[model samples]
Target: MLLDKSVNHDEVLLRTLAGRNFYASIQTVVKQKSDGQLLLYGIIEDISERKHAEQVINELNETLMKRAQELESVNKELEAFSYSVSHDLRAPLRALDGFSRILLDEYQDRLDDKAKDRLSRIRKAAQTMSGLIDDLLQLSRITRVELTVKPVNLSQLATDIIVELQKEASEHQVSCIIQDNVTALGDAKLLRIVLVNLLGNAWKFTRNTDQAVIEFGVRSSETESTTIYYVRDNGAGFDMAYADKLFKAFQRLHSANEFPGTGIGLATVYRIILKHSGRIWAQSEIGQGACFYFTLGK
Candidate 1:
């Protein structure tokens, strides 16, 4: 190559006499002398350390990609297994409930009060099991569903859920305050589910309160850039000691008799929040009230 007045730089791999390979950065400068002769000046720098670091970063990226793929595959398999098992378990439960109902309806005259009570208990247990199975299936489906993210009007969702709850129990006197124009970026369907569970829990827990009140609103975080949304209710709250178990499946702080539930609603809500890269937590005191706070990822 002909040498010009301009400087040139290049990176290349070099091998030593002992057959050791390394990377080098070379810079060359060319000039013409007064005697009409060309002079060449060059500098070579060993860049082996930089090249090694780059190679390590590339390898780490590849490993992370592989691990992510494996995890996705395993998650899909687990969801499918859970779905199949839940469906299969429903059959036996249905049969148990049906037979117990038949005995109670047709053979009630021949059976004593004690026997009838046992059969009724059996039927009730079967029905509870069926509810648990349905909740499990819902959780499994939510885990695998694809998220279509967009702007969601959370205020409207909470209002709609409250309306439904009121329709279900018209006799219950409850006051609901929903802030207007509270929005978020998330999957509309999944976010709706979150509101339904939170609002539904609030409605149920406040059933016995003399003056029940539920509020849905948002607040800005001084320490963080994201907005914090919350659902607050003046109803039967739980102890803070068991807050750690709040988001777990089948973990209930209260007895079924006090507040009937499948114990999977919060778990489903937790999973949906995680799917949106968000977090959920609650604060409450016994007989006081409860407030659930959450933030969605950007």
Candidate 2:
């Protein structure tokens, strides 16, 4: 047992002879006490599987990080695009509406009756377009606003809104009976818009009836856990076939001559309801009546 070199013989020198994992050899420089000689030393083991696993894990993490970065970039781009459309596009529409109205008023004598009517129509369309653009801007803003659940007095709100509407009435006998103790958690301003649009639509559509009847109150549904309040009206109700398209942007069931609107009202209502975590739906038939039911989250 004479040796002149030291080696870690734990793995049986797996790289020396045949370089196998289970069996191996070791070379060394050894000399007796009289003479000295030397030999090469080699020791290796198979760790290929473990190294491959580590490489795969590192590659997976890299791919996941890149995917997350891409999603974040997409989100930022959408926000910037919304800002551009809402902020930049409405400036020219305002100018168009303002100038048309100004020309009509200041140059009344310069335009004949038909010409003036056409000009008036143009101004009306422009103003309507402006209103539509404003609604779109509002819709965009609604998406970004943080909503909170606060006490909303639906009864008082309905009464106030209805009284305001009645102020503009000439010969329409439309009244509201807002049930007492109808308060809930919702955005008051947005809820007011919901009331305004729903009730205003009711009032406008019922223009042809000899006596317009509209009501606002809560009604029980077997399916819902919350009290569903609805604005019911005897009006020019639409066909059920178009009901599915009712809440979409720029979708109008009636022509501008019959019932004029920019078709953004229902879309606004839908957005407001969604923001409140509520639901809204309408039931109507041609010339019967329409009812809009909505409820805020509890």
Candidate 3:
């Protein structure tokens, strides 16, 4: 075949006489000498190790892809279940709140102080549960929503959220210092939610302080390429022992009586940051202030 110029180079899987399988790369060369004699030369290289390595890598890739698909499917099922349960609970909550309100309105003259207070408590509990359900739905939506990534002005978002918080709690005085031009690449709407919860918590926890100071700023890391954004507040901070539970649903370091919240805000923030492939953490002491730091992944 080499003399006839039928084949120049080829790769083949061959089996030895002992039944051992291997791969080879073969190259053929034909030359004519001045003495009019033809010379045929052939080179064969054993490529079995490289071929085996490639096969193993391909198999591993396939397995990883399958696992990733399975995980995604399970996550979708759990999200659907959460949405259905939350939606179902809202109806009963609404009924409870409505009936309690009706009783308070119609039977106010007939009911005593204790009875009225009990009804009001029932109404309040139901309302709080309803709010929690709403927050759960929002968290679920955050997980499922498609991210529209773009340049987001986080400083502007923090300022806007602070303005809204001030309008709601006009009596509480808070000094907010927002850094200028602190921008990031993320979903603008979702990042806005992050600021809303962080700044709102700062504002809420600082209500009792004589001079409340909340700061939103960014700092560059010398060791890493990511920028660290932070929300710091001189307010009712929390114990560091429970910091690990800060991002879980229904987990609160402070009691509802002390700081009125559904406890899902941080969880929602955590989910949004995870969706952006980022990390969030907090530092605090019992009486000292709290500072939340986060890095958005590139």
lDDT of 1: 0.91
TM-score of 2: 0.72
Q: State each model's CA lDDT, in order.
A: 0.91, 0.80, 0.89
Residues 12-122 of candidate 1 have per-residue lDDT tens digits of: 999888999888888878877889788888888889999899999999999999999999999989977887887688899889999999999999899999999999999
Better of 1 and 3 by lDDT: 1
Could you give candidate 2's per-residue lDDT for residues 254-273 as a string of tens digits? 99899888898899999999
Which pairs, if any, clash in model 3? none
Candidate 3 residue-wise lDDT at 50: 86
lDDT for position 246 in model 2:
91
Candidate 3: worst 10 consecutive residues by lDDT? 1-10
Model 1 clashing residue pairs (backbone): none
